[model samples]
Target: MEEVDVVIVGAGIVGLSVAEKLSHSFDNILLVEKEDSFGRHISSRNSEVIHSGIYYPKNTLKAKLCVKGNELLYNFLEKNNLPYKKCGKLIIAIQKNELPILDELYQNGISNGVKNLEIISSKKAKEIEPLFKSCGALFVPSTGIMDTHKVMKKLEFLSEQNGVLISYNTEISAIQKQDDEYILSFKSDDFQVKTKILINCAGLWSDKISEMVGINSEKNDYKLLFCKGEYYKTTKYKDIKHLVYPVPDPKGIFLGIHTRINLNGELSFGPNAYYVDKIDYQMDDSYHQEFYESVKNFLEIDFDDISQDDCGIRAKLQKEGEKFRDFVISNEKNKGFPNFINLIGIESPGLTCCLSIAEYVEKIIE
Candidate 1:
């Protein structure tokens, strides 16, 4: 068995971020990925939005990390010459009744220390976005979009440059915790490694990974719920300047089907939330009308202009009707699994929180 000081599973944004930061200090770092390349799952899919730390409960990991990560990510992007847009965002309220929710979101953002969040009147919103029709809007100046692929590639490059050994097409089928190290067995390849630290950054299979090491995720209230969100690309809007979002679902289920502008000046709407049994990228056309209605509620878009784009699954901890759930980043020493770090239910703001999350994990290991 090859022995290492640290083993990081999964090559998603968060995992890559962790490896890149830790590689600066730690030697013999091994990053293992199941896919042939990095970021095949959640990292590659979705809006690639740099969330502005809004909507999450105050003092939660999601809130703190996202707000902090927003700053760190922008700095990292600039330093590395990675492409991104500080294109801003607007959470709009269409009906008069929804204005309260808009206020609540602004307040929540303020409580979470999000800067430059404002409640703009209809005329002010129109001045910013003429096509946007709303009673009121929460203008979030910090929200932006970046090329996730570019970000991941840069992170991978930096990590590799620092002597981080990345093993692709290798999946950890099982894991066992010895006295002070973890023994990881590969699925197809007959190989195992003993590492002093095991960081479970596995995006979708995090709960399963926890269970493999005798950690009952459910008992610890870190159970995984696979919620799939589908997006639809728009043909009508191309040069839209900012991300246009509807008021969040009243049930507090999701951020609602909103308009996301990519870094390449492309527009897509969606990520309407629903549960899925298995991981599949196949887009269902049945929800196109639903997408149309949702977009029409906030933006002036015809149904025919939108087409089925793609989908991404979120590793959620909260089930349907559950108002809120925070990201679970824990060093399981108290659970008898010292040096084993588990990150669970890292969904929406996860991409935004990648760098800050890495710093959080670094402090834990220290």
Candidate 2:
């Protein structure tokens, strides 16, 4: 048995961020990952957008943490010499009727303390983005893109520098709460170990992990709906300057198809949300036609050059037709394990809000 003060499962951004903060306060911290490399899951597969905290409801954890994390992330990137760009974003209203919704989003953003969100006229929008055609748009200057893998590496490095032990290829088998601490069982290629305090940041398998610890009562009320979003790269427009997004559905389960330019200056649009049974990354070429039709209303580009790139799954906590749900951070209250914490359905803005989630989890442990 290799006892530790804290054991963090999953080496995704959130887990690594939590380890980074806790490493400074506690020694004997262990970070376990099932993958051969860190961030093989949601952390690496996202659109890499540093969100501006515009959509979430006011004062909720998502809104507050996203706003705060936006500031913290940019500062951290600058301090660490990471590759990132504040390319900005535009939420366009293609239909005249959708303009009201766009306006409401702008007001909501203002109320949420999202700085520099402006509602620009269609002419102004076209002036800003010559290829964009819309009735109206909301400009969010804080939205941007970054090398998420690099960010994760930096986080892991910092945590390791502070004495947090990272063990890749290690999978947690079970967790049990003892008198004063958690007893966690983990198996790796070579060995097995047990630890004390358990931090369940196991992205997709979070509910299963909680159940393993006999915390079924605290398991998410809504089943994890695996919504896989597929992206397509545009060979025609390779150097787009801004992220172009459509007015999100009022329900807000999925942000409409949008374009994001990566750190390499390659433009890609996608993630048309589709519910799936398994975590599959297979891109269906048939959807490419649908992508062309869906995005043509807002963007003026040659769809002939569009091709499948990659796909990422969102651990959506919301049921079908329901609005987007907030991140679930469960501690002793629901689970009965004093030191055990589980983070479930941490999807979009999750990459942006990773550090803030870490700080929140730290407060819970303390």
Candidate 3:
């Protein structure tokens, strides 16, 4: 058996961020991941766009963390000599009726303390992005993109340098609280560990981890819905600068399928969201028409110009047609579990909010 002061389950960005930040104050800290390498799932997948804290409601964790995280992440990336671009973003309203949504987003963004969010006219938008089709656009200069893989690598390096032990290919089969410490059992290798503090940042399987520790998901409304979003890469559009997005559905459904530009100056559009029962990453060509139709209104592309590229699953707290739910990050002392912190339903902006989320958990513990 191994003994440690703190054990952080899941090596996703959120977990790794927490590990790196806490390593400064805590000793004998351990980070365990089921995968052989770090960030194989929710962390690596989806658009690598650095958000501007525009979409979330004011004073919510999503807005605050993302707004603060946006700055922290940029500084971290630059300070670490990582690759990134402040390419800016545009949320366009193709329909006249959607103009109000832009206003609402602008107001919400201003209230959330997002910097330099201006609703630009279609003429101004065309000056910035000539290929875009828009009636009006919310110009968010703070939004950008980064090398997510490199960012995670640096965090892992910093944590290890700070004396945090990260174990790969180790899964927590079961967890039980004995006295004040947590006893974690592994699936194989006859491995078990004990830690005084347990931090659950297990992105997709976080709810199951909580249940193992006797916190009911339904009772706490902490259940996660697996929303699968698929992307399509374009061979035609590479020079288009800035991230282009549609006005988000206010019903609090999914963000519409939008554009993604990687560091190589390649362009892709996608992540049409839908609910799924199981964890699956297999891309389906059956969505070719849907993908084309979704983007045709914003981008000029023939159906053949786009091809299925990749997909990722979002562990959302909101089910299909459910209203918005803020990220459920809490230290569950009131739930009779002290020294236990749970982070669930961290979806969009999780990447941008990774470091701030860690700082948030650090505040909870300190």
Candidate 4:
């Protein structure tokens, strides 16, 4: 029966970013998380790569927000003393036939205002990463990686300092709209609290959360398809300085098996896309054969000791055989509920775009 100004569900990066921004303006804010800690879902499971916003179509939310967010994130990390690296990335064209596609990608990056993107010859590409063998490549100097968990922790701390209450292990059951306010029912520990504005930032379960609010169900137009991607870690540390990528599939849904190094300088690969029926993270060893075949085309590696590390699911708005969908941040109109916002299908570059998404959401509510 407590009345609060805002109730944000899901403690992932997006929700936490929004909460951090909202707390600066609103005093009575509650951040609820079904899990015991933040970033346990999609936020923590990703490749932790800070995207350069080169792949998305121009003028779309993904393109604009990701480009904007990339700058903001770099600045934030530097200012806050967080761990990060602007290690750059290389989009490699392994075969002769893929050269044209590589050119198209370089032009797309330039058109999208991606700074310092250069088309390097195969010889120059080898200078950057000696082990990589490619016909041609595009070097994205702005692409980087970071510790996603550390960033989330900083956001959480900042929000708490600004008077935002973070309630963990809290699950929202139902939501209803009454006049200008939204009533949210959630259980925390042994108690429950109902509040006015409810922001659903549930990454994977966002669709189910929308249905709970009487929106985007079988009767509605919006739907979410869960896509699972798995990652594998290489045992031997190869000296690949930059993040190496193969020419993206024309469909643009999957970014072929690539190489990424973490903050500790450990190399990891994979995240091949596969559509799934349910949300699960169980690693299947049988997929190793498929992974080896997929990655062997671009880089040579000893897969002898390679093992499954982790997996992440992307909540996509598109169905099977569909191109990548843009981020959907809606409030009220789509579901007829004022002060209730639903963010569905926030996948790749999501971590990079977290700050920009938060700033946009704050403007919407303001």
Candidate 5:
């Protein structure tokens, strides 16, 4: 069996960020991923939105880390010459009834310490985005978009250059805590490893990993609910300069389907949410009319203007109809697993919070 100082499971953006940050301090660090390449799942499939810490509750991990990560991400991107746009975002109210929700979000942003957030009138909203239809809008100036693939790749490179061994096409089938070290069973070559520290950064399968290590996922309330979102694109609505959003779900669930401009400067909309039972990436076009109906509340679009583009699944901790849940990150020593760290429910704002999440995890180990 191979021995290492630390072993991090999953090589998504969060895992890569953790590896990059920890490699400088620890030797013999190893990162393993089941996929043949990095960011093949949630990390790459997201809206790639650099969240502004607006929607999350104040002082929560999502809010604090997102705000801190926003600054860190910008600095990291600038230092590495990564491509990103500080394009700003709008959470709009299409009717008078929705104005209160916009104001509430503005207040939430303020409480969360999000800077430069303003509640703009429909006139000012039109002045900023002439095509958008809104009664009022919350302007988040710090919101932005970035090339997620580029960020993941750069983190991979930096970690490797710093002597962190990253193995692709590798999977940890099982793990056992043996006294002070964790013995990991892998898929290939009777491959096994013993690590003094085990960090579970597996995004979607994080709960299963926790189960393998003797933590009852259901009992611990660490179960992951798969909430899938679908997107659509349109060439007719060209030149969308910034993100445009509808008022969030009344239950504080999800931000409704909205418009997003990719890194290539193309206009697209979607990410209507629904719970799924399995992990499937098939794009369902059945909601074509529904998408049109929902999006027309905030933007002008013809029925024939859009087509199904892509979809992504979020490993949410909050079940349908449940209120917001914070990210689950902690050392499991009290749970009978010392030096074992688990990060569960790392969904949206995770990308924006990657570096800060890594820092938080590092502190846990220290």
Candidate 6:
């Protein structure tokens, strides 16, 4: 058996960030991932949009961390000379009935302390993005796009340079708490580890990881519902500039499918949401008509403009038709597992919230 001071599961951006931050404090740190490389799942998929903390409600972890992470992420990008674009974002209202939702988003952004949020006329919206159709829009200047792969790679570099050992293709099949240490069982039978502290950052499988440590996921409302989102791309991006969005789902199941611009100045649209029982990333044209109908309200394009691209699944704490659920990042001491931290339902603003999430977790250990 191997012993380490700390072990962090999941090598996604959040886990990598935690590793990099904690490396300065802990001499012995291990990061384990089931995938062959980091960020292979939720971290690498979907739009790499750096959010402006606009959509989340007031005072929640999503709101606070995202608002703070927006600043921290950009600072990290600039400080590291990473590739990114501060392209701004426009959330649009296509009809009079939707104006209230736009206003609601603006107010929420203000409540979350998001700066430079403005309710702009359709004219102003079109000026920023000529192909977009809107009656009114919420302009978020701080919203931007980034190369997530680069960001993850840089974090991986920093973590390694700080002497954090990352074990790839390693999966922890089971975990047991004995006295004050956690005994982790691996599927490969190659070796085992006992850590003084465990941080479960396994995004989609976080709930299952919690279960391994005697926490009843269902009893504690930590059950994760797999929500799958698929994307589409188009060459019609020639005129598209800034990021554009439709009013989010009122149930909060997702931020509505919107225009996702890449760093290359090309545009892709989609990530239409639906709950799924299995994890699958195989893309299909099943939602073609639905996507065409949705984004056509906000973007100018022919029905033939889009074809299915890639897809990703989110491990959300909110079940179908459920109310908004904040990110479940917490220490489980009172639940009887001291020094064990569980990060569940980390979706959306998670990319924007990575650094702040790391700081919050580090504080828990300190």
Give the per-residue lDDT digits (tens) of candidate 1, residues 70-150.
Answer: 999999999998888898988888899998998888889999999998899999999898888899899999998999999
For candidate 5, write residues 131-237 as lDDT tens digits: 98888889999999999999999999999999999999999999988997899998775878999899999999999999999999889999999989898999986
For every candidate structure, what is the RMSD over all alpha carbons to the true structure, in angstroms?
1.0, 1.6, 0.9, 1.6, 0.9, 1.1
**lDDT by residue for model 3 over 202-311, one digit each (tens)?**
99999999999999999889999999989999889786788889998666767788889999999998788888999989976999999889889998889999999999
lDDT of 4 at 338: 68
**Candidate 2 lDDT tens digits, 275-329:** 8899877776879888888778877756687889998999878778876578888
Where is model 3 poorest over a 10-residue stretch in terms of lDDT?
A: 248-257
The backbone clash count of each candidate, in order, is: 0, 0, 0, 0, 0, 0
- Our tally of clashes for model 6 stands at 0
- List candidate 4 segments past 4 Å from native: 188-194
lDDT of each: 0.91, 0.85, 0.91, 0.85, 0.91, 0.90
TM-score of 5: 0.98
Task: List candidate 5 segments past 4 Å from native.
Answer: none
Ranking by lDDT: 3, 5, 1, 6, 4, 2
Worst 10 residues of 4 by lDDT: 187-196
**CA lDDT of 326 in candidate 6?**
97
Candidate 6 residue pairs in backbone clash: none
In candidate 6, stretches whose alpha carbon ends up further than 4 angstroms from where it belongs are none
